[model samples]
Target chain A: MPDNLQQALGASTNEPTASSKSNLKKLPGDLAMWFFILAELTVFAIFFIGFAIAENLNLVMFAEGKAQLHKVAGLINTIALITSSYFVAISLHSMRVRNDRQAVFRLILALVFAAVYIVIKLWEYESLFEQGIDIETNTFFTLYFLITAFHFMHILLGMVILVYMAKNAYQGKYNDSSSESEFSGFESGACYWHMVDLLWIILFPLIYVI
Target chain B: MMKFWQRYALSWGWLIILTMASVAIGQYFQYATLNSVLFIAIVMLIIALKGQQIVDVFMELKHAPSLWRNIMLSYVIVVPLIITLIYI
Candidate 1:
């Protein structure tokens, strides 16, 4: 049988029997992607450590800058990203099980939460900009904008990847219940989206609450 | 093992509850007199727990190789500990 038909039938039948097993440790998505994820995490970790060090030096300025932030917005965005992460996990599982329809639904839900996060972030940025706050305002604001804006770009990229995944699901590309091998795109995209969420999870407390 | 919704939904519930809890902690610190060190310790602990959930459940690291899993787990545990120390 042709690969597409096999996958389509697998999707309808709801069995992942074609999955191949390996004795070696298996990371989700592509091995290259895992390397990328690790690199991204390391960079963020260093940035966070730097932030902590800076705060230690100018405790009062850091506190004042943090006070200017809208904690409510930060909290809401955190919820949005976490919820989106949950949906992305569900969607990835759905794809693994060849339930492309379920995968599509979950992906759409994930995108909705992502949209909420972006909107709230943009609102926060606008508010800050209107108040004449920018990266150059002070050291704290500079790091704040730098870290978050960099993260915001990742969120945007993750969304684009998700849209591609959703499109693939709609076309039945994820229907290969027999082989987890083919759906690297889905796994990788979901992993990237989760990393975006994970970064925000730490960032929220470090930047806004601390 | 628990069914699909049982596992995923429970994790999702925990994430949402923790988010609320962190916000509440922040609010309490904003109003009450507390040592910054103690407040930071608590916040970092909560952040570590939250990060662990995402790594184990969402990232599927729980099923990955033990080595990779431990390394990922340590990132959450150690980073927060170090950050808390710095703040203190």
Candidate 2:
């Protein structure tokens, strides 16, 4: 296989040393994909700092804007993200056993979670629009829309990647001929999903707790 | 720590605990000038540690060509330090 393709597929050379292949995997592979994760994290951190600055400048507005947010929607998104994280964890576990079908199934469920979050987020946005608030209304709205929209963009990207992984799985790319490591697609997918979840973890407080 | 750290504790456990602690600290103490810098540094460290652990285990950058790993590691360290200097 081509190096680039192999990288996407995330297959290590099938030559597993005795020490390497010895037992159950306790954790997912920590890959360069994490830096991809880190970039998203950095972006969220910037938004968070902006939130802090805004709060200091106008605590009342920040507090009022936060109260305007749909707490139930936010909570649902949190649950979705957490549920998706669980699926990613399961997908990795399935990958360890070389159970390609099970891994793909778990990943698809994660996609469903993402979609659920987006739908509810859209509902929340529309309701806010009806309330005469928007990105240009003030700094708080601007930051709120920007952060959530940026997050939605990431969900879309993750969906695309997960879709590709699922398709490849159905094609038997992970059939018995290959070891689990031979397929890095799911690994990368799961990592990205975790990044999304981590951002939401921060956002939960930024939008609601504060 | 590809093998060693992986053997000790799942890295995510460390990540979750650190993050929760950060959140608690963020909640109790308002962001003062000194506090902001201190918290930011702590957050940066968490991000760095989690990122490095993930790279080592998931990407197997540790198993890839050493030169590639070294080069990327340099970028990882330098980029955040520069970010700190510029932002702070």
Candidate 3:
């Protein structure tokens, strides 16, 4: 897609016109973001149902199992994700303001949050397992491990993208693009980061509250 | 009035408020079983709305070529329902 918004308002951003950037078409970044989201949601749905089913058989045990989780750790992860989402927004906003340098900086901030999220999640999981609550022991841990393990994977992927975008900016690939390429890359990054944030949104309550 | 609403009243503002409200209600109804379920549902709803808003506004899919925007939105909406129908 050409970056000329005056022209692109009537055009599709999916059709990258720059021959040099044709490989971008193959990635289909937006659709891929949502596709991964759908798949993750499907996995979470199974975990949720399994949890409820186990609850039906043994509500008290499930409740006891849930109470064992660390609320402080969960809240910390929630704050980290929420802050990363903010950084994602700031990065996108900086791009709109034509500040590529600032955009890269904000993405690094998001990466920091993703790293903190991973560290806290692993620490929490280790502590929980030490308490003798394995995923196979019951429904609570079953849902907990599946949801968090998948989210940990996403944090890893987002960190990779952040690093890639940072390197691309260093090389000036994203800086000189037509308005469309810049906007497209920035928006796609936000789309992916937001997907990460959205997963944690649902995961937080699943593991923490309900 | 509408422009003001669109700016200050961006959907996420309302969503954050709704999130806070849900948390408050969860605290008050601490032991209510169905409310716990509702709490999670509300959180999911906010996240869904936020995702759609990002795609629609920042991605500019809202004003994109109809074929792309419609189909994309359709998948976004349908995927969640299909997940629920098949699992939850």
Candidate 3 residues lying further than 4 Å off, grouped into runs, are A3-37, A178-186, B1-18, B31-88
Order of all candidates by DockQ, from best down to worst? 1, 3, 2
Best candidate according to TM-score: 1
Q: How high is the lDDT of residue B13 in model 1? A: 87
Stretches of model 1 off by over 4 angstroms after superposition: A1-25, A176-180
Candidate 1 whole-model C-alpha lDDT, 0 to 1: 0.83
Q: On residues A13-108, what C-alpha lDDT tens digit does candidate 2 reach at each position?
A: 333455544331222334566566656667776776676666667767876888788766776776676666666665655555566788789888
| Two-way lDDT contest, 1 vs 2, winner | 1
User: Tens digits of per-residue lDDT for model 3 on B26-71?
Assistant: 5565665564444545544554565465456534455455665565
Relative to the true structure, candidate 3 reaches a TM of 0.70
Higher-DockQ candidate of 1 and 3: 1
Query: How does chain B score by TM in each prediction?
Result: 0.92, 0.66, 0.54
Q: For each model, chain A TM-score?
A: 0.86, 0.82, 0.78
Error in Å for residue A72 of model 2: 1.4
Cand 3, B chain, TM: 0.54
Which scores better on TM-score, 1 or 3?
A: 1
Please tell me which model should have the higher TM-score, number 2 or number 3: 3
- Model 3, residue A139: what's the lDDT? 61
